[model samples]
Target: MLEKIKNNFNTQTWVLIPIAIAINIAIGQLVLVLKLPVFLDSIGTVLVAVLCGPWAGALTGALSNTIWGIAIDPSAFPWWPVAAMIGYMAGRMAQWGFFKSWWKVVVTGFVVAITAAIVSTPIAVYLFGGITASGSSFITAYLLQTGQGIWSAVVSTSFLTEPVDKITTAMLAFAIVQGLPRRTIGGYPKPEQVEVEGGEGEGGANNTQMYIAIGVVVLLVLFAAFMLRNILGG
Candidate 1:
């Protein structure tokens, strides 16, 4: 099974990789059409993670949204990789069969959100957090203020939004992957290519080009989101 997967990676990555990346970016833009509170594009990141595993997911997630951050929230630019990688890890965990049930998926979603928050909170606080009286406001305004440092503000803000983003994204990814027709990643597999004699390796997980494709996708989506958000005042 591993051998087959590796072969798939060796062969079609160059071609399918770019296409997948494009699809992911376009999907991210399309998610904007829904205007959900959570970022639905995380679904794409998760899907990549689940199918191709962590590396692709991480690469794709970090890249696409990192650019998005730079373009959209300039102050939050550093967080793009943080968000994408979190999504990548979450999706990878799910694909490892961590989210077999609906409730499990929800829990996984929350887990991802919290994980993202934990990973990103400190960086946000140290970098751009001192922006307004936001941190001090937490100390004075919010009742349960432990303190007001980079950690507090980052954790607080992330706690507010990361869970929502994670849950929504995980749920969405679960549904999409479940619904997708089980075939090769590229599409209906060629009749010439029979299912190898082993357990299901990631349908097209072997494709290395897939990563390149995902990377391209990440860049394009970030660019698009950056431009679109600016235009729409999002």
Candidate 2:
């Protein structure tokens, strides 16, 4: 187990973790400021997960939340576990070859969304009474006002919001990986995890997959915007 953990980190992984953390914080802060229902914070975490390995990914997530909480938003402090699990699950999915194609990345995002919802439910219910600082708290608030229990409300809110956010994050991460040069990707611990199908390790296939991922990301963003408008309008 120790060796496995050790193998996940190299000079590139170490360097990437800090950059990934910054990405998480910057994008997260922007989303929070916009009061959007979706949290597009974990794009960096997913990026590290696919390029490095699970342990490295998990570490990036924990650190991302910790710093964000301390420096940006205190409410973010308690949710590190959810972020960590997102990283771990993404890495595991990639290891299972889910990151090799656009469709598989969507599945990975859904699974990660479920994992995040399950992990965060207890935190949201116990720590913040299902109404935290996130814009998605509006959904929980609306649900609770409708007489749903706190646990049910929070979980339902998460299930509704997390999928599109996570799916978009995963797709963006995949697209970024696809855009990276082959030699650069080779420096990572798990470059093979991102080798696109049909190209068999060549750049041509990855370019096509990356374009598809970007298109899907744009569509998800529009869908999220629509959902946000409805949630906020109601």
Candidate 3:
């Protein structure tokens, strides 16, 4: 296991981690500033997971959240495990060939989101009394007021918020990987993990897939908005 984990890191992977961490922190802070409902913070984490490996991805996620917490907000310090799992799961999905196409990438994103939700629940429940500083915690607070258990409220909030953000993050990461030069990508530890499934010749099909991914993200955003409306309107 250690050997497998070690193989995921090369000089390029090492170099990528810090950049990925910066991306995570910058986007996360931007979302916080904008009061966005979704946290698009894990794009870099998923990118590293797909391009490097699970271990490296996990490291990037952990460090990203840690640095963000230390330098920006103390509240973020406790969620490093959730961030790490996001990276780890994204990497595992890529290793399993899920990163090779737009639809599979969506699946990867959903899985990562679920992992994040599950991992974050305990932290939210125990560390912060089922309410953190995030906007999503409003959902948890409302659920608690309605007499839901703390775990249920936190988990429900996570379920409501995680999928859309994570799926979007994965798709964006995929787009970034597609946009990068082949030579630059080749320097990464697992460059082949991100090779488009149908090859570049299938441009039309790839375009269709991209559209589907975009449509899904739009739908998820609308769903989240609807949920927020219901929660607030209630």
Candidate 4:
């Protein structure tokens, strides 16, 4: 087990971790600045997981949140465990061959999102009284006002919001991997994990996947708008 874990790391993996962490932080802050409902922060975590390995991915996620928390907001510090689990789950999904095709990647995202929801619920309940600083906590606040318990309110909010963010994160990461040159990808520790399984080299299929990812993002934006309207309008 130790050897297996160690094998996931190399010079390339080490080089990728800081880059991944930076991506997480930059995108996270971007979303916050734009007041986007979805976090969209874990793209780097999933990317590292697919290209390197779970442990490396987890380290990226943990450090990403930790550094961001210290540098930006102390509130983000408590959520490092949730970020770590997102990385671990994404890496495990890739190991299970779930990151190859667009559909499988969606499933991987859904699974990771569920894992994140589960991991974050307790923290939100005990730490923040189910009222996180996140915009999604408005949903939780609504649910709580409807007579739901803290756990239920938090979990429901996560369930409703996490899938869209995580699925998009996974899809975007897959697209990034697809767009990279083969030689550049080869430097990663587990490049084989991201190799397109069949003849997706055809331009048409690649375009379709890109469109699908874009479509998903557009739909998510619309849904977020709708949700925000209802949440605030109430």
Q: Find the candidate with the highest TM-score and give its number.
A: 3
Q: What local lDDT score does residue 216 receive in model 1, on the 0 to 100 scale?
A: 42
- Model 1 lDDT vs. the true structure? 0.54
lDDT of 2 at 57: 91
Candidate with best lDDT: 3
TM-score of each: 0.60, 0.85, 0.93, 0.89
Can you tell me which runs of candidate 2 are displaced by over 4 Å? Answer: 30-37, 199-234
Q: Pick out the ten consecutive residues of candidate 4 with the lowest summed lDDT.
A: 198-207
Candidate 1, residue 224: CA error in Å? Answer: 30
What is the lDDT of every predicted structure here? 0.54, 0.86, 0.89, 0.85
lDDT of 4 by residue, 37-116 (tens): 67789899999999988888888889988988899888889999999999999999999988887877888998999999
Per-residue error for 219 in candidate 2, Å, reads 7.9
Error of 1 at 206 (Å): 30
> Per-residue alpha-carbon lDDT of model 2 for 1-234, expressed as tens digits?
999889999999999999999998888778879986567899999999989999999999999999988998787899999999999999999999999788788889889999999999999888887889877788889888878888888987787778888987888787788889999999999999998876355543455665776676668667767875776577
lDDT of 2 at 192: 95
10 residues in a row with least lDDT, candidate 2: 198-207
**In candidate 3, which residue ranges exceed 4 Å CA deviation?**
32-35, 199-205, 229-234
User: lDDT value for candidate 3?
Assistant: 0.89
